[model samples]
Target: METALTLQRTRSLRWRWLWLTPPVLFAALIAGTAIGETSISMDTVLKVLANQLLGADYAVDRIDAGIIWNYRLSRAIVAASCGAGLALAGVVLQALLRNPLADPYLMGISAGASTGAVGVTVAGIGAGAFSLSAGAFAGAGLAFGLVVLLAQAAGGGSCNGRSAQASGAIILAGIAGSQLFNALTAFIIARSASAEQARSIMFWLLGNLSGVRWDDVVLAVPVSLAGLLVCLWHRRALDVFTFGADSAASMGIAVRPVRGILIACVALVTAVMVSMVGAIGFVGLVIPHAMRFIVGSRHTRLVPASALAGAVFLIGSDILSRILVPGQVLPIGVITSLIGAPTFALIMIRGMRAR
Candidate 1:
């Protein structure tokens, strides 16, 4: 009865907290843009947004309008999407592998994605009017397939029956593949015959939101939405897996096939995101970990909470990117790595101590 009461209380709390998420996330995103050197008041920011959104289409000022619309707003959305995608991927990978440390990039997805993006940028894969996102998508697809194949090889073909040892082996293979892809990417960067080509490759690899448009948002939204739905639908299965494969199987879960499909879906979603935004890192790594404390590991709660947390984190980070230096903006990826790496290290150290 006490346990039941506790669960009820917890659910109540989550229900209340969930209501605050959207406003807080949206506020943070808008506020992040208001902090730069040409700092606009929140009132002005809101007004500009209201006017533009309400189809007034009149600039409070040309400068404020440009800063608010052309630059900061788009960047915020990109950051939020990247964050949400990464965190969702992280949760999916962790659950699929049944390991706290598993991430989408753990299986060399990023490296493969990077290779494809870099190859296109350097090799000039598209003709005039072609898009870099196409190459990025192709790269992400190839890399994702390779990781699954390598994991299967490590897992003795079925790859469905996951053991700690199998998980470890899969991780190692991913690392190796990532390293190989990174080396090739470096070679492409080095052999670039022109400064422009080299610069483009470097910027893309570094990750940025400089030229983001409605089109980028359009491409990313459907894929991200689909992936989120998949994650949510499989949440119960993920919770079951935490208990063990046998336990999950006993509960009628088809562990292997579900995991494979989830992984593929996450990869496809992530590949599209990376193709669009370059390789933004660590939102996945950080957000899910943080949300787990609030929501526990129940997929129903975890999936939505993690998505919100991720969106919050990345939007905040992107806002920081623009305002961090006057007249200079850093890549969203760099901000995430800078903030995420230290947080990750702390999580690692804490885990080691607990062990």
Candidate 2:
């Protein structure tokens, strides 16, 4: 009875905190918009948002309005969308693969996307026709396909039965695929890129958000929403996946089809985000783990918690990237790596202690 009561209390507390998530996410987005190199007041930010979003005319400085609407707001929205999408992808992969360290980029999607973008930019792969994003999407698909084939060849053909071995095989395949694509990207840079082109590719590979605009927001927002909906729809299946695939199959889950759909969803969402912002790491890997601690292990709570926390965390990270080194913008990936590396270490230490 005491254990049951304790569990009930925990659930109630998690739900209570969940209600606060959306407001906190909104505030974080607003703060991201307001605290750039040229600080715009929150009031001005609100007025600009109102003017642009709600068709309300408030007397805001034209330059501030333009910066808030065109630059910062769009960047924040895209950052949030990317964060949510990556986090959801992480949650899905970790759950389905039964691996604590699984992430959106585990399938070599980022490396593949990078290679494609570089091929287009440096090697002229598309003869000046395909956009970088198209190249990236294509490359990501190719890489994922290769990783899947490699995993299957290595006896991971099914994500059921001997799940641990299957998971390990897939992880190894992903690493190999990532390394191959990364090498291809480097080779293209070495052989074909001028200093200027190499510099641009390097910046983008570190995750650049300076180029994000309203057009990106259009693509990112819907993708994130769709990813979240799909994950949530499979929340129960994810919960059962904690016990491995055979257990999930015993529970009436169509483990193979479900796994395929979720993995494909993650691949598509992750590729789009990488194509748009380069490769931002750790958001996917860290955010889901962090949310599990806060909201408990239940996917019903964990899914949305991970999404909201990831969105807020990225917005905050983006804000820091802009202001951390005054007069110069750092790649958002650098900021995340700085934060994620230490946080991940601490999480590992705690996990060891708990065990």
Among all candidates shown, the one with the greatest TM-score: 2
As a whole number from 0 to 100, the lDDT of residue 127 in candidate 1 is 52
Task: Go through the candidates in order and give each one's C-alpha lDDT.
Answer: 0.76, 0.87
In the range 1-355, model 2's lDDT, one tens digit per residue, is 9999999998898898899999999999889899999988889999888988899989999999999989998999999999999899889888877888778566587788888878887899989999877788788878878977898999885445356788888788888999999999999998999999889888988888999999999999998999999999999999998788888899999988998888778877887888889888899889988887789889999999999998998999999999999999999999989998899888888888989
- For 285-309, candidate 1 gives per-residue lDDT tens digits of 7778878767777889888888878
True-vs-predicted CA distance for residue 89, candidate 2, Å: 1.0
Task: Find the candidate with the highest lDDT and give its number.
Answer: 2
Q: RMSD for each model, in Å, please?
A: 2.7, 1.9
Poorest 10 consecutive residues by lDDT, candidate 2: 155-164
Per-residue error at 149 for model 2, in Å? 3.2
Report the poorest 10 consecutive residues by lDDT, candidate 1.
154-163
How does each model score on TM-score?
Answer: 0.89, 0.93
